[model samples]
Target chain A: MRYLKLIKVFIKTSAQETLMYRANFWVSLLHAFLNLIVAVLALVILFGQTENLNGWNLSSTLSLLGVYLIVSAIRNLFIGPSLEALVGLGQEVWNGQFDFTLLRPVNTQFLITFRIWRLFSLIDLFLGGAVLLYSIFQTPQSPNLLAWLLFLLALVAGILILYAILLAFTALVFWNPGYLFTWVFDAIFQLARYPLGIYPVGVRIFLTWIIPVGVITTIPAQVISGQTGAPIVFLILAASVFLFLFASWLFNKGIKQYHSASS
Target chain B: MNHRGGFALIKATWFSWMQYRSFFFVLAFGWMIPPLVALFVWSAAAGEGSLGGFTRGEFITYYLVLVLVNQITYAQVNWTVGDIIREGTLNHWLLKPLSAIYQALSSELAGKVVYLIFVIPVGLLLAILLKPEIQTTPINFVLSLVATLFAWGLRFAWGFWLAILAFWITRADSFLALQDSLVFIFSGMVAPIPLLQGSLQQIANILPFRYMVGFPVEILVYDLSNKAILFGFLMQLTWLAIAVLLSRTLWVKGIRHYSAVGG
Candidate 1:
C-alpha cells in the first residue's frame, strides 16, 4: 500500500514534468502513427508475396506487431524513461547522482522503476490496442472470454519478463558504467516483433532460452490467437517470476559494488 | 581545407571512440536486428521454393550484405548535429580553424571504424553459418563499393540538412524520425524492391531512400543487367547531388537563422 502511494506520487510528478512539454505529445503522436503505418506496410508487402509466413498469416503477424507495440509502449511509459535516467549514457550512475537515489529511504529498485514516466506513450498504447482489436476481428478465430482472460494474464507475464530483461541489462551498468549495455538487449528485443517460429532453429532456441525475447511477445500472441493453451501461460508465468527475482538479486548485487564518485 | 588537420581530427576522434568500442558495438548490433529479422522471415517464407526469384539462400545473402552495407552507410552523427545546434554548441565548432563539418565527419568516420569492428565479424559469422549465396563478380563488387560510398554521402547529407532544421524549429528532431520511417518503408529493409508490386516498386525506384541503403546491397546481391546497374548508379548520383545541394543551402540559411535567434 505504501508502495502504491509512492507510485502515485511518482506518477504525479512525472505527469507534471511531461505537461510542461506539450509539443512532445504531438511529436510522439506523429511518431506513433508513422511507426504503425511503416509496420503495417511491411506486413502488406510481405503478405503480397505469399499467403503466410511460417504459419503466421497477415492477421496473426499483425497481432504480433500489435503486441510488440503495446509492450514497447509500456516500456517507454515507465521502464524505459526511469531506467534510462538511472543507467543510460552520462546519466545518474555514470555521474554518481545514483548515490542520492541509494541514500533515499525508499527501496532503490522500486523508486527507480517508477520515478519517471513518458505519458506520451499512452498514445502508442491506444494505437496498439486499436491494432490488436482490428487484427483480432480480421482473424478467423475470435478469442472467447476464457481466452481473453488468459491473454490478460499472459500479457502481464510478458511485461514482467520484459522488465526483468531490461533490469538485468541495467544492472550491468553498475559493473561497466561507461558501456550502454541495454542497447544490445534492445537489439535482440526487436526480434520479438515477429513470430519466433520464423527464425532458424538455432537462433529461435537462443532467443527463447538465452534471451527469451521470443516468448515475451510470442506466447501472449499465441494464446489470444488461439494457437496455444493455458499450460503455456503457467510456464511463462513461472519464467517471469524467476526472471524478475533473478534480476532483482542481480541489481542488489550490483548496488553493493557501486563506488560513488563524490565519495 | 587542411588535409593534415582533417586527418588529425579523425584520428583523435577514433582514439576517443575506442574508449567506448563495446558500447558502439552494442549499438551496431542493435541496428542490425531489423534487417536480421527480415532475413529470417523472408528466408523462412522461401523454404523449399523461391519467392520473387529469390531462393532461401539468396534471401540470406541479400540480408547479410545489407547488414554490412546498412551499418556502413548509417549516419549516426546526424543525430548529434541537432543537439549541437539546439544547445548553442555550434558556436564552438564555428570557431575551430578547420571546417566545422569536419567535426561531424570525424565522429562519423570514427564511429564507422568502431562499429565495423563488431559488425563485420558478426556478419562473417552469419555468412559462414547460414551459407549465403555469393553471386557477385569482381566488377560488380567494385561498383557496389562505389555505390555504397555514394549511399553514405546521400544518407549523411540528407540527415545533416534535417538536423540543421533545428536552428529554425525546436522540434526539428521529429523530422529525423520521419526520415527513418521513410527509409524503413521505401528502402529495401522491409522487402526487396523487385518483390514489391508494380506501383510500390516504381515508388521505391523514385524515392531517394532506396538509394541510401538498398541500391548498393541489391547491386552486390543481384545479377542486374548492365542497363539496370547503370540506371541504379544514375539514380544514386542524382540523389547524392540533391542531398549535397540541400545540405549546403540549409547550413547557410540555418546559420543565418541561428544568429538571428541570438544563437
Candidate 2:
C-alpha cells in the first residue's frame, strides 16, 4: 500500500515533465509504427518468395511479430524504464549521490525503480495491440477466451523472465560502477524479435538458457496459436518463477557490495 | 587543414576507438547477427526451391555481404550531433580549426576501421561455415568500393543534417530514429529490392536510403550488367550531392540560430 502511494506520487510528478514535451510522444509513436511496418514488409517479402517458413505461414509469423512487439512495448512502458533507473544508481554511488537515495524511508529498489517515468513510451502498447489484433484476424484459427488466457499466462511468464534477465544485468553495475553494462544487454534483446527455430542448434541453446528470449517470445506464440502443448507453458512458468527469485537475490547481493563514493 | 593534421585527427580517433575495442567486438557481433538470422530464415523458407530468384546459397551470400555493407555504412552521427547541440558543446567544435564535418568523418572512419577488425574475422568464419556463393569480378570489387565510399558519404551527411535539427527542435533524436525505420525498410536491410513488391521497389530505387547500404551490397552479391552498376553509381552521386547541400545549409542555419539565442 505504501509502495502504491509512492508510485502514485511519482507518476503525478512525472506527468508534468511528460506533458511539457508533447512532440516526443508523437515522434515516439511514429517511430514505433515505422519499425513495425518494416518488420511486416520483411515478412511479406519472405512469404512472397516461399509460402511457409519451417511449417510457419505468414499469419503465424505475424502473430510471433505481434508478441515480440507487445512484449517489448510492455518493457518500455514500465519494466525497462523503471529498471534502467535502478541501473543508474551505480552512477549515483560513484558521484556520492546514492547516500541520499539510500537514506529514504522506502525500499531502495522501489525508490530506484519508481523515481522517473516516461508516459510517452506507452504509445508502443497501443500499436502493439493493433498489430496483435491484425494478426489474430489474419489467422484462420481464432483463439478462444481460454487460449487468450493461456497466452496471457505465457506472456506474464515471458515478461517476468525478461525483467529478471534485465535486472540481473543491471545488478552488475553495482559492482562495476563505471561502464554502462546495460548496453551489452541491449545488444542481445533485438534477437528476441525472431523465432528461435530459425537459428542453429547452438544459438538455440544460448537463447533458451542464457538470454531466455527464445522461451520468452516463442512459447507465448506457440501457446496462443495452438502450435504447441499446454505442458510447455507450464514448464516456462516454472522457469520464470525460478529466474525471478534468482535475479532479485542477485540484485540485493550486488547492492550490499556497493561501497559509496564518500566511503 | 593540412595532411598531417587530418591524418593526426584520424589517428587519434582510431586510437580512442581502440579503448572500447571489446565493446565494439560485441557490438559488431550484434550488428552481424540480424543479417545472419535473416539468411537462416530465408534459406529455411527457400528449402529446396528458389525464392524471388534467390537460391538458399544466394540468400546466404546476399545477407553475408549485407552484413559487411551495413556495418561500414552505419553512421551514428545523429547521436553525436544531438549530444553536441543538446549539451551546448558546439562551442568546442566551433573553436576548433577544422570543420565539424571532418571531425564526424574522422570518428566515422575510425569506427569502421575498429569495427572491421572484428567484422572481417567474423565474416571469414561465417563464409567458411555458410560457404556462400560469390559472383565477384575484380572490376566489380573495385567499383563496389567506390560505390561504398559514396554510400558512406551520403549516409553521414544525411544523418548530420538530421542532427542539426536538434538546434530547432527539443528532441531531434526521434527524427533520426524515424529515419532509421525508413532506412531499414527501403535500404534492402529487410529484403532485397527485387523481393519488394510494386510501389515499394520503385520507392527503394528512387530513395537515398537504398544507395546508403543496399546498392553496394547488390553489386557485391549479384552479377549486374555494366550499365546497371553505372546507373547505381549515378544515383549514389546524386544523393551525395543532395546530402552535402542539405548538411551545408543546415549547419549554417543551425549555427546562426544557436548563436542568436544561445546567449
Top candidate, metric DockQ: 1
The TM-scores of all predictions, comma-separated, are 0.95, 0.93
Residue pairs in candidate 1 whose N, alpha carbon or C atoms collide under 3 angstroms? none
Model 1 CA lDDT for position A82: 92
lDDT over C-alpha atoms for residue B111 of model 2: 88
Q: Write the per-residue lDDT of candidate 1 for residues A68-176, one digit (tens) a residue.
A: 9999999999999899887766789888999899999999999889989888899999999999999999977689999999999999999999999899888988898
Where is the poorest 10-residue window by lDDT in model 2 chain A? A85-94
Model 1: which docking level applies? high
Task: For candidate 2, write residues A14-123 as lDDT tens digits.
Answer: 88978887777777777777877878878887787778787777887888888888888877766777767645434575676777888998787767766777776567
Q: What TM-score number comes out for model 2?
A: 0.93
Tell me the lDDT of model 2 at A99.
Answer: 76
Q: Please report, in order, the local distance difference test score of every candidate based on alpha carbons.
A: 0.90, 0.82
Each model: TM-score of chain B?
0.96, 0.94
- After superposition, which runs of candidate 1 have C-alpha atoms over 4 Å from their true positions? B260-263
Best by TM-score, which number?
1
Question: Which portions of model 2 show Cα errors greater than 4 Å?
Answer: A88-90, A110-115, B1-3, B26-30, B260-263
